[model samples]
Target: MDVNGRVWLIEANPKPGRTLFIKTGERKVYRTSVRRPLQYAMF
Candidate 1:
């Protein structure tokens, strides 16, 4: 964000860390994160 409070996305990761959610006990999110792309590709 800048002084005017406007947010900007500078970069993105295609393959992000997958274990963080599991370490934080967010199993559902971890599963969805792993599954959604496969589902989309299948369709």
Candidate 2:
């Protein structure tokens, strides 16, 4: 963030750590995150 309190996105990771949500006990989110891309590709 800057002096005016505006946030900036300086970088992004194309492949973020996948196990984070799992570690946080968000099993449903983890499953959906892994599933959606495969479903989209199959469609």
Candidate 3:
């Protein structure tokens, strides 16, 4: 899901997809790849 978990929580489906019995807003970001990183954005 995106940064806002509140959104896209449910879709318009009468059959019902995967039921979300529980949801925790706890999230953590981490980098698992090693590469040259630049701290600047090219415009």
Candidate 4:
């Protein structure tokens, strides 16, 4: 559980979105990006 200097990116299931998880010592951070309706329109 010593997740220091570690960075990772992951995708959330059951929906269209992206997530990122980062950890450093006792601190942890997360970032998530959900595909916007307009953004998906191009696809």
Candidate with the greatest lDDT versus the true structure? 1
Report the C-alpha lDDT of model 3 over 1-42, residue by residue, as the tens digit: 567655354544534312222223222211211111222212
Structural similarity to truth (TM-score) of each candidate: 0.59, 0.61, 0.14, 0.18
Residues 1-43 of candidate 4 have per-residue lDDT tens digits of 1379564646436432233233332223332223344465466
Higher-ranked by lDDT: 3 or 4: 4
Clashes of each: 0, 0, 0, 0
For candidate 1, what is the lDDT? Answer: 0.86
Q: What is model 1's C-alpha RMSD?
A: 9.3
Best by TM-score: 2
Best of the two (1, 4) by TM-score: 1
Of 2 and 3, which scores higher on lDDT? 2
The C-alpha stretches of model 3 lying farther than 4 A from their native spots are 4-6, 16-43
Which lDDT values do the candidates have, in the order given? 0.86, 0.84, 0.29, 0.38
* Residue 1 error, candidate 4, Å: 47
Least well predicted 10-residue stretch by lDDT in candidate 4: 24-33
Model 2 spans > 4 angstroms off: 1-14
TM-score of 3: 0.14
Residues 3-38, candidate 2: write the lDDT tens digits.
998979787675777788899999999999889978
Error of 2 at 43 (Å): 0.6
